[model samples]
Structure formats: C-alpha cells, structure tokens
Target: MRLSRFVSAASAFLLTAALALTGSGPAHAAGPVYVALGDSYAAGVGSGSYDDSRGGCYRSLRAYPRLWANAHTPSGFSFTACSGADTTDVIKRQLGPLNASTTLVSITAGGNDAGFVGVMTTCLLNSSSACLRRIDRARDYIENRLPARLDALYDAIGSRAPAARVVVVGYPHFYKLGTSCIGLGASKRRAINDAADLLDTVTAKRAADHGFAFGDVRGTFAGHEICAGPAWLHNLTLPVYESYHPTASGQSGGYLPVFTAAV
Candidate 1:
C-alpha cells in the first residue's frame, strides 16, 4: 500500500509540473499555424546559420519567425520569406503556403522594391550627393508606386489566408545621428534614416488599411542601430547581403518581443 501511494504521489507531482510549464512557459500546446513571409530581414540573412536547401533565400534558423516557432511550437510553420524578395515576389511566390488554416503571418518587404541594394551600393561606394540623388528617386517610387503593389500583395494574402493575423514588420533606422560615425557621413546616415522612416510609415499605413498589425521595429532598434555601441544591425559586413540586416540578437531581442505581443 505504501509503495503504491508513493508512486501515485510522484506521478501527481510530475503531472502538476508539466501542467504548470505548459501554462506559463514559452511553448504552448498545439498553437497557431504560422506562416512567415517577406524579405531578407524576414529570412534572417544577417542572423546567419543559413539553411542551404533554401538556396539564395538565406533563411536563418535564428530569424524571429523561427525563434518564435521554436518557443511556441506552432502546429505548422511555413517560412517562405526569401532573401531579396520584393512585394511582387511575395505576391507571386511567397503566398502559396498561406491558406485558410494559417493563423499567424509576419512580413518585411518594400525595401527591395525601392532599390535597396542599388541605393545602398551607391551610398556606400560613392559620394554623399550620389547617395541622396538615388534616395530621392527611390522615395519617389515609394510614395507613388509601392502602395498599389502592397495592396495587391495584401489582397493576395487575404484571399489565401482569410483567417490569419498578419503582422507587417518594418525596417529600422540604420544610424544614430549627431555622433561622429565612421563609414557613412552624417548626411548619408540622416538620409538613410529618413528613408527607413518613410518606408515604415508607408508600410504601416498599408498594413493598417488591410486590418493587419504593423510591427514597427524602428523604436525597438533605437540606440541599437549601427554607430550605436553593440548594434543589433550589421554595418557593411563582408557577406554584404548581411549588411544592414538584423543580427541574431535583433531577431530574438528586437523582433521577437514585438511580434509575440502583436500575436
């Protein structure tokens, strides 16, 4: 009788502990079906640990969507977000995994559509005037052309995953101004930051119009941008594609919390 009672007590304790962890820990039992969609930032280019099978998509294991999935253990997760994916790319290629069963979505795009690489290349390799001129042209595209594209992509997502809670994540300011920053000049840094702000504003508005949550990481990245000590974003790294994207810390410490709260 005593042996049976001890075994029962031990079993009850284990069950209670498991229940407590399930209730309070990061992992939830049979959580939402998540589909992550967007650009290099979403694919975790800068965060490294690339999944080679993804080819040039460069999806990283440390990316926020993956980290969130690792923690929450969603029933299903489709990470179709590709490196260098533009809005059109997303609409055409990335929407397949999303469906009526998907419960959560996150995306970061439009930078590529606005000639992110071109502008950055011009800025980093040329004079400040060159950078500003390209920025002006890009801003024109952002203000005039990107809206329709975003609408088209949003419509596609809605049609495919009508029940999903989409979170459109935006870019962060790349520099901390007013300090003597190496690499990029003050004007260049300011212009880059302004462009980031504009992109976020436009993206946020479109996401809001579609009744989606806009996860703005600008505020979260403040004081952690390049030129700030211990920056979460890389500054002109060797891989180059990794440059200007979030590090692993940013994915975990920056993007994850904002995404989690929104979800």
Candidate 2:
C-alpha cells in the first residue's frame, strides 16, 4: 500500500511539471497584442533600412514601433503604418490591422492632413511672405476643418479596438528657434514650430475626448531639432523622399523614450 501511494504521488508531480513546461499551467498568460498605425513618422521614413515586404510604406526596422516591440516582446505585433498616410488613409486602410483582440495601438498622424508638407515646401522654396501665407492656410485648415476629422478618426479607433489603449502621438517642431540655420529664416522657423504646436494641441484634445492617451513628443525633440549641433531629424536626403523625416537616432532616442514612458 505504501509503495503504491509513493508511485501515484510521483506521477502527479511529474504531470504538473510537464504542464508548466508546456505553458499550460494556470499562471501562464499570453502577452499583449500590439498594433502600430499612422503615417511616415510612425513608419520611420528617414530612419533607413526599409522592410521590402512593406514596399512604398517605408517601414523601417529602426522605427520607434519596432524598437518598442523589441523591448516589450508582445505576443503579436502588426505594423500597418505607411508613408505619407493621412487621417483618411488611416480610417480606410490602416484600421484593418486592428480588431477585438488588439490590446495596444500607437499612431502619429494629422501633420499630413494639415498639409505640413506644403507648408514646409513653400517656406523652403519660396519667399518669406509666401511661406507665411501658406502657413496661415494650413493653420486655418487645422482650426476649421481638422477637429471634425480628428473626432471621426478617434471615435473609429475606439470602436474598432474597444479594449486597446490608443496612444495618439504628435509631431515635433522641425527647426529650433533663436538659432542660425540655412534655407529657413527665424520667422519662418517660429511659424513652422507654432503650427506644430497647434497641431499637437488639436490632436491631444481629440484623443482626450475619446478617452485615449496622447503622447506629446515636442519636448523630447527640443534640443535635437534640425538646427541642433547634431540634428536628430534629417534636413535633407538624396532621394528627397526622405527629407524632413526623423533620423535613426531620433527614432531610437527622441520617439522611443516618450513612447516608452506613455506606454
């Protein structure tokens, strides 16, 4: 009877150990399912080393989403963000990756919708007055038209990924003020920075209205703007397609830290 009892106890212990090793134990749980969505910044446009699989989207390994994923090791990760994507593109195309199973979502958008590229181009290639006019136009759009669009996007994100923590990341000022820089004057620099600030404000307010968290990255890129000694953002690139985007350092240093803190 004693021998029989000892054998049964040993068998039960072995079975429990096997279940633990196989990850079938009660303590075992799946990691978070993270989905990254937005535009070029979130896709790491100028960070270099694009994933060919994603094609024109220019999803880079050095991008913040990848960096965040590497550190966190979520059970599943879907990086659906593309280059040059606006809020409309996100609502139509990017939302496909998100679903009921998603637990986390990170997005950096609205700059494109506000015609930021046009503002930069006018400032860089045209007269100061022309730059101001373009800036004013963009700001008008941001104030008059962007709020409703942002509300729609935020609401859609919330509805689609009900359980996910949506983080709306904002853009940084391209130029540092009160500093000498080539190709752009101080006034132009200040105007562009002001526009960025306004964009962040609108984006943050929309996120809050939807009960989503906003990741403010303006302060993180403070000393590392285009005019910095060693700039974090690319002033220009050979392809020109990569211009004004974040460098690899910016992705790893500027964006990663702020995003990490928020998450």
Report the C-alpha lDDT of model 2 over 1-263, residue by residue, as the tens digit.
99999999999999999998897877757788999999999999999999989779999999999999999899999999999999999999998878899999999989899997898889988999999999999999999999998998888888889999888889988998887788689999899989989999988998888888898888889899998867889886677978999999999888999888888
In candidate 2 the C-alpha lDDT for residue 189 amounts to: 87
Misplaced by over 4 Å in model 1 are 1-29
Candidate 1 overall Cα lDDT vs. reference? 0.91
TM-score, one value per model: 0.88, 0.92
lDDT by residue for model 1 (8-121), tens: 999999988998878753664567999999999899989989999977999999999999999998999999999989999998889888888998999888999999999899
Model 1 clash pairs are none
lDDT of each: 0.91, 0.90
Ten contiguous residues with the weakest lDDT in model 2: 23-32
